[model samples]
Target chain A: MARRQAASAGTSANEAAPPPEKRRRVRIKPEERYREFVSKAVELFAEVGFDAGTRELAQRLDVTQPLLYRYFPSKGDLISAVYKEIYLDRWKPGWSGMIEDESEPLRTRLQHFYEDYTETIFTPEWLRIYMFAGLRGVDINARYVVNVETDLLMPMARAVRRELGLDPDAPIRPEEVELFWTLHGGIFYYGVRKVVYGFACPIGKEQMIANAVAAFLDGAASVMRGFAAEDASAPTAPSTRRRSPGSRR
Target chain B: MARRQAASAGTSANEAAPPPEKRRRVRIKPEERYREFVSKAVELFAEVGFDAGTRELAQRLDVTQPLLYRYFPSKGDLISAVYKEIYLDRWKPGWSGMIEDESEPLRTRLQHFYEDYTETIFTPEWLRIYMFAGLRGVDINARYVVNVETDLLMPMARAVRRELGLDPDAPIRPEEVELFWTLHGGIFYYGVRKVVYGFACPIGKEQMIANAVAAFLDGAASVMRGFAAEDASAPTAPSTRRRSPGSRR
Candidate 1:
């Protein structure tokens, strides 16, 4: 009875093993597979845009269509994952601290921060994907802009005020935000012109950043002095109450 | 014989008239048709982007695919036509003269110029197509940027210098270019954020432009003063010789 059972099991194993080499698949762990899919998908999306078909992506990934579906159920899901990785995950933790460190000259801090920041976000992939999202009318670009304005530009403006010997805790002015956006947008446009639009900037990136930072610092100091002069000249009315304790009237 | 000929002609005419309504085609002049095609194509391209299929555009125009092909040999040709119409054709000839008119205060000149300029290019269609062309890696955007810098910004920088009692014919400084770009780019980003990216700005368009222009003029004057101070303090090196007759060393 034992010999008969062993013979039956051996026959079933042989049937299962027939043409096994052709049917075998590489066994990637599920977590590893999901990450690989996102990485490859980002490249493909950045190359051809988010509208590229899954068949092309699957072909690029050298995987079956079903395999891609197993990782990301829909194209939108994949795009959301891509946005998270590109916008959210890529931001460095120490960037805010770098800008706020007060020990370094404002020009050096700005120049260094932009050099590092641009290195992370100013690639063709980042700029193209950003424009792609904007053109597609996705809110991702707007949300990212808000994040930059609030987290980066706002703090940088306060830092600029501090560096210029103004009260850092003063209520931020619209002109201050606009000025920061000018410097930030000017530098960002350098990337847009170079990476997205493929224009050759007459100046290299480092020199451009240095020049922009120097001009910004100089301009900010002058603007602040003008503000002080205006305050001194204006009649103090009841409406002239300061919004912040440390704010200049 | 005449009666028989008339009878036969009437019989043929009667036969031709049976489906006359269905067979008749609108007799649009070729020039009119070409203009109509271009106008419609711009709207469609601006709406859906350059990657939109020709068939879809033809459908939108209520014409056949062959008719569109008759007007434009290829999609690329159609896009070129769109670029020419949007970027080149829309520019007003009087804009440079407006900026160069130093009789008016520099603030008024800049304000008027930008208002007119933004009205021409800040529509959803123009901004969208501009971004689309940029993302598609087309030279339209780069060419447009160059045109704007040359026609608008270079002259504006000289105007600012003139307003500050500096020589107008001086060789343009990189700082001047970058500063003008900051102001120009800051305003442009306002349109991009509001119209293209659909972000709500804290201020209205007119207010934003007013703030940006005021900040720009003030910062520019400040920057010029700093340059003058630096020039006064620097050693009279041979390399510091003026490149232009109006330039200061």
Candidate 2:
């Protein structure tokens, strides 16, 4: 009787109490919530990797575990979403056009393109997730490599051939692909060294990209000249020549 | 009485119950046992990573946990031994002499040196352990990078300068170091792609190294010629120039 009297006294004192609207759950669109979960999950996965439990993710998202599961059924499904977002969705369509833009000097175009590309991908989130995915033995890295080869490397090879006065339609050589990968991998390694391994890179990103592009173009030109010289000195039998690897396109 | 009779019957069947000498523990020198433990530990760590427990290691070594601790004292101590063996002990003293040998062509020398170096390091065991060490936030990878830069990259820069008819004792440009790293990192990435990521490289090791070295030499030569041409035309003030990072050496 005393407790009831005290509760009544409290209610009487706060006769101007607000309605229950403040305690109600806020409604959000499903698509918007899904996007929010993916963005937040990318950060959490990058920070703690796939080993992070769903409880941790839920805490980071400020949501209940059941709410997180409502969006992503499992941790692997969430990681798959992250892979798609990062590797597949993040590629700007204009990059291909920029690479093939013959109006600009190839060196300037390459410099601008890589600077922009690295700006997008050289972040701690991207690099760490990439390493984590590779460590987990996922096919995402290999798939991304194949995408890079087909989308970027092949076009770059054709451009190099065009600059060298070789037939643009001619098949690309294995050596050519390897040389391009050397430059590309070198730049990527700089990111790995700095972002992943936490090493200090003495030079800025633009400077490194510029140096790599200069070296690649110059070296490729010299190699092409050597090939031209060899062809002039002794015309080889075309029948014995091996097919170029780039002919598949 | 029945148990006693059974025991006596078993002893009688064995006739002599072979002397205790036949069942005695085999004695091994402490130092030999320590070396044996380290060797076995390296294999286990390489296969399973530094997370392998002391009990696991002991089981692999066919010894008791107490016996394993007698040599390593702790897991960290065993990992330290592994770092020493892989990074420091595996380096061949003759590699420095090979790089300095001017009698052979630079291409041939680079090809031979990388071939030998890769043979030592490109194994699955070494590559996985290296990645594991890096992921574990150990100083081993950083220490190894410094060793490579000082011992290998610096000497290579000098050789490139000499080849370009520049002063061999002159400061190595950041560009020079980057170019060398491009070649080195590219080659290293090839090993990573194959061993760690389980990707198949279309080209063999020898071909890839030859292509990279050839590209590097040609590129460095062309870049040097460009610098010379610019200096001849402009005659810029040398005092205003920024020093190369390698000048610290």
Instruction: Give the top-scoring candidate (DockQ).
Output: 2
Query: Which ranges of candidate 2 are over 4 A from the true structure?
Result: A1-33, A53-55, A63-68, A224-249, B1-74, B225-249
**Candidate 1 recovers what fraction of true contacts?**
0.31
DockQ of each: 0.15, 0.18
What value does the lDDT take at residue A126 in candidate 1? 83
Interface RMSD of each: 11.8, 9.5
TM-score of chain A of each: 0.80, 0.80
| Cand. 2 TM to true fold | 0.77
Q: Write the per-residue lDDT of candidate 2 for residues A6-91, one digit (tens) a residue.
A: 33334555556543345335778999989988998889878766666678787676676788778877777888998888887888
TM-score of chain A of 1: 0.80
**RMSD to truth, every model:** 14.4, 12.7
Error of 2 at B189 (Å): 1.4
